[model samples]
Target: MLKSLITAIRTLTLFSVPGRDTESFSNTLFWFPVVGLFLGLLQALFGYGAHLSGWNELAAALVVLGGVVLTRGMHLDGLADLCDGFWGGRTKESILRIMKDPNVGSFGAIALSMHLLLKWIAVLKLVELGAFTFIAAGVLLARLTQVVLASALPYARREGGTAQAFVTGAGWMHISVASLFTLLFLFPLLHQDLHALLALLAASIAAGGMTGLLSYKKIEGVTGDVLGAASELTEVFVWISGALYLLLSGNG
Candidate 1:
């Protein structure tokens, strides 16, 4: 279990591992939320420190940068690929080919820029509102979406790629375990506020479902890039939802 946890962390972040353990890596799906909690803790600490230092804006920017750095920009790259493929490719073959390419096109560049900008703005708003809890929760929810995508969707590629092992190995049982972990983390944060909890749940489901549907329509299945895109889109959705909730409730 410890090895699986380590594999989850190493695979999801820029963290180094002593050695590659394929078996452990295969079991890492169940621990995805744990890795997310670790990330959330880091961001929460940074946000709290920023609050104390009277540099919330700077801290928020750093938190956003930290996410990119920690994840090695893999999610962002996936988002770019998805954008390029979905819009640029008219056929499944073309879409797969486009997504597999390492080069970023104009559409991809625009999408990445917009995504980063929106994320920065959302984080800035969260910091200003002192909603560190939401930041942490957003990370957890975003990662949970990835686990769902892996377990629920068939891999689009026939020639198995980087994410194939995970998708193939993760079953409904794994999804159940990951969902349990997510609820364990989320319940306490939201138990006192049913409205907030419901809103967050709705937002997460909507984001994940929408992304999955789009991926399915475009390619008939999900890819590693789709999972990456889903993670990023879900994070942004959570942040946006939380920020809007705060604003509407007169807290912002």
Candidate 2:
């Protein structure tokens, strides 16, 4: 179990831990939310401290950077690939080919720009509201969405790939365990504000579900890029929705 946890950590982030990974990620998937919760806690703590110190704006950008640094920008690269391939390609073959390309096209550049801008704005608003604890919610749900996604879709790469082991081996048992890990951290967000948390969970479900639907239609299944895109989208959706909710409720 400890080695499996290390696999989850090493696979998900740039964090260096001493241990060999299990041959397969079926069990490693169980630790995904655990890694996410760890990332969320660090981000939330830094954001909270920055808020108290009156550097919330800089902290917001750094919070965004913290995620990228930890994950090594893999998810952002996936988002860019998804945008470039899905919009620029005329067929499935072309889509897959384009996604495999290392170059980011016009579509990808625009997507990265808009996505980063929106994420920064949403995060900035959240911190400005003094609700820094909720920062963990978005990060936690992002990783959980990936776990759900891996379980929901067949691996798209026919020749096998880095994510095939994780995606193909996933099941409900994995999701259930990951979900428990996710919720264990939520109680500290608002003490008794589960309604908002549940609503955010629903929002994440919708975001992840939409990614699955689009990936299914695009290439008839999922790739590593698809899973990464799902994580990126779900995190931003939760943050955007939470920011809006707080603003509308006069809590901001």
Candidate 3:
């Protein structure tokens, strides 16, 4: 269990150790939310500190930048690749080929910019509302969405790829475990406000589902890029939902 926890941390974060066994890294999918919890704590700390310092704009920017840096910008890369492939390609083959290319195109640049802008705006609003808790919850839900996608979708690559291991190794057990972690973290954070919690969950699941459906339609299954895109979209959707809730409640 300790090894699995370590493997989970190593897999999801920038942290690494020499001679670490990766044989069970896929099994660590059940612990993805655990990593999310750690990420959320960091985001909350950073945002809270900036809020205390009366730099809400800087806080929002830093929180978004912190997420990118902490995850090594892998999800952002996936979002860019997904946009470049989905819009730039005319067919499945072209889409897959385009996504594999290391270069970012016009579509990718636009998509990445729009996503970051929306995220920054949402974070800024949440900061104004003193709603740092939702940032952590958003992070947790983002990873939980990944677990859901891995368990539900088959791997897209016929020749196998980085995502194949997790798709093949993870199952309902993994999903259940990850969901348990999500509920454990999320419920306490939002138990005082059920409406906000439900809205965030609904938005997150919807975003993840739409992402998976699009991937299935395009590639007949999910890929590493799809998973990454799903995570980023889920995060954005959660933040948007929470932000909207704050606005409607006159808290923003």
Candidate 4:
């Protein structure tokens, strides 16, 4: 268990776990949980601390910005690419072509703006509801979405890169292990609310499934970028769902 965790950390973060090298694609599968947990914890700390500190919306936004910087905007870049692809082209092939290009298109710019705006609004809503746990879960599950993509799809690229290494070694077992840990962390926050728990789980499953299908139809297969985009977008969906639930249930 310790080894797996260390492997996961090495793959996900800047941390160099003993003998692990980031350049090797084989170690990518091991990092999913590590990254997910780390990012999740950070977001939790940020939200909880901000709320406790009586920080306003701007301060809360800074916490999220801190997270984005910590992750080096890796997922955001993918989100932009996905946005460009989905909106720029009429055909699937044309979309893929735009995604492959390093340049950001107009669609990408618009998408990035909307994503950032939505994330800020979502975070603000959670803060308003005092739902720190949901904010943390959103962060965790976003990264977990990446793990699911890594586990389920093949990398599009041939020569080994970050995506290749991860997709190559990831199996159902890795996803299961990551998911087990994710659920454990989430269980504490559910506070015995079986209905809310089930709702969140169903939402996550549906979001992931939809992303997977989209990846297959548009990209032919899932690449690292696709996986990253899936993580961020799924988190957005989960956040919206959680906010709505809290608002409607009078729990927020």
Candidate 5:
């Protein structure tokens, strides 16, 4: 179990969990959400400490940023590539062509900017609301969407790419492991606010639904870009949903 957990995180994130590097385990499909949970755990520990220490919003934000930086900006790169491809290309073939290119286009730049700005603002708001747990929960929800995409969709292209392994078939057990780990990581916060917890789960489902539909229509399947987009989109939705929950419930 310990080794498999590390394998899941190793395959999913930029982190290289050290151990035996046999091809069979190394090539195993990465569980996206499980990686997110590991990342979230780091963010939660650091962010909570920052929040408790009376750190400003910017400092807290930097803690979250640091977690991504340590992961080598893997998801962010995917988000940029996805934006470059999905918006720049006029047709299906063109989109795939643009995605295949290594260069980052104008559409990608704009999309990335918007995504970062929104994320920054949302994180700041969460800090203001004292919703540290929600921040962690948001990370979990976003990553779970990645697992759903990996399990449900086909590879968008004929040739191999980043999202190929999981989409091809990572199996139900892999999915369950990812999902269960996410829940365990998140369970600590559930004792604080049940409604917020449920809201995060709901937001996750919605994010998954949105991603699933978009992938079906736009690419006819999932790709690295699709998975990345799902991560970012789900993150955003979780933040929004959690914020709204706090507002409506008079908890904030």
Candidate 6:
């Protein structure tokens, strides 16, 4: 269990876990959300502490930058690669080929720009509303969405890839367990505001589902980039939903 937790941390964050990774991806799956919980907590702390100490805009920017730094910007990079491939390629073969390229194209650059802008806008609104928990929830839901994506689709590459080990043998049990842990952790942070909590969950499901469906249609399966894209989209939707709720409730 400890090893699994370490593996999960090592996989999800830049944290230096002392031990080696667990060989089986499923063995490390149980702690995915736990790793997310740690990230969310740190993000919430960064946002909240900044909110208390600095300007709202500063807090928002700091939290946004902090999250990217924490995860090494892997999710955003994945989203960029997906944008370049999904929009630029003429066929599945071309799409995969485009995505594998190390260089970012026009599509990828625009996608990254839009993603960061939208994220900053949403985070600013949440910070102004004193909704730091929503920031944490957004990050947590992002990771949870990745678990579902891994379970729902086959690895797109026939030759396999870095994420193949995690996605190939995933099943419902993996989703259910990861989800259970995710929701349990969320309940405490989100329980007081049922509407926001429900909205967050619904938005996460919608985001992940749409991402998976798009991947299936475009490439017939998923890759690490698709999973990253899903994670990035899920977090964006989660934040948008929270902000929308606050607006509708006259809290924003």
CA lDDT scores, all candidates in order = 0.86, 0.86, 0.88, 0.73, 0.72, 0.89
**What is the C-alpha lDDT profile of model 4 across 142-220, one tens digit per residue?**
7677778877887765444556766777778778877887787788776767777777777777777887888777766
TM-score of 5: 0.86
List clash counts for every candidate, in order: 0, 0, 0, 3, 0, 0
lDDT of 1 by residue, 39-146 (tens): 877877777787788887787888788888889999999999999999999999999999999999888999999988998889889888888888888889989999
Given candidate 3, what's the lDDT at residue 70? 85
**Candidate 5 residue lDDT tens string, 1-252:** 456556667655667777753334422434455567667667766766777777657646775586567557667777777778877777777888888788888987887788777777777677778777777778777777777777777788877786675566555665676678677767786555667778888888887788788767877887877877778778877887877888788988
> Which regions of candidate 4 deviate over 4 angstroms?
1-7, 14-19, 22-31, 89-97, 158-161
Clashing pairs in 1: none
Alpha-carbon RMSD, each predicted model: 1.6, 1.3, 1.4, 2.7, 2.7, 1.1
What lDDT is obtained when candidate 3 is compared to the true structure? Answer: 0.88
lDDT of 6 at 24: 82
The candidate that wins on TM-score is 6
What stretches of model 1 exceed 4 Å from their correct place? Answer: 19-26
The 10-residue segment with the lowest total lDDT in model 6 = 20-29
Q: Against the true structure, what is each candidate's TM-score? A: 0.94, 0.96, 0.96, 0.86, 0.86, 0.97
Best by lDDT: 6
* Residue pairs of candidate 4 with colliding backbone atoms: 8-30, 8-31, 25-165
Residue 180, candidate 5: how far off, in angstroms?
Answer: 3.5
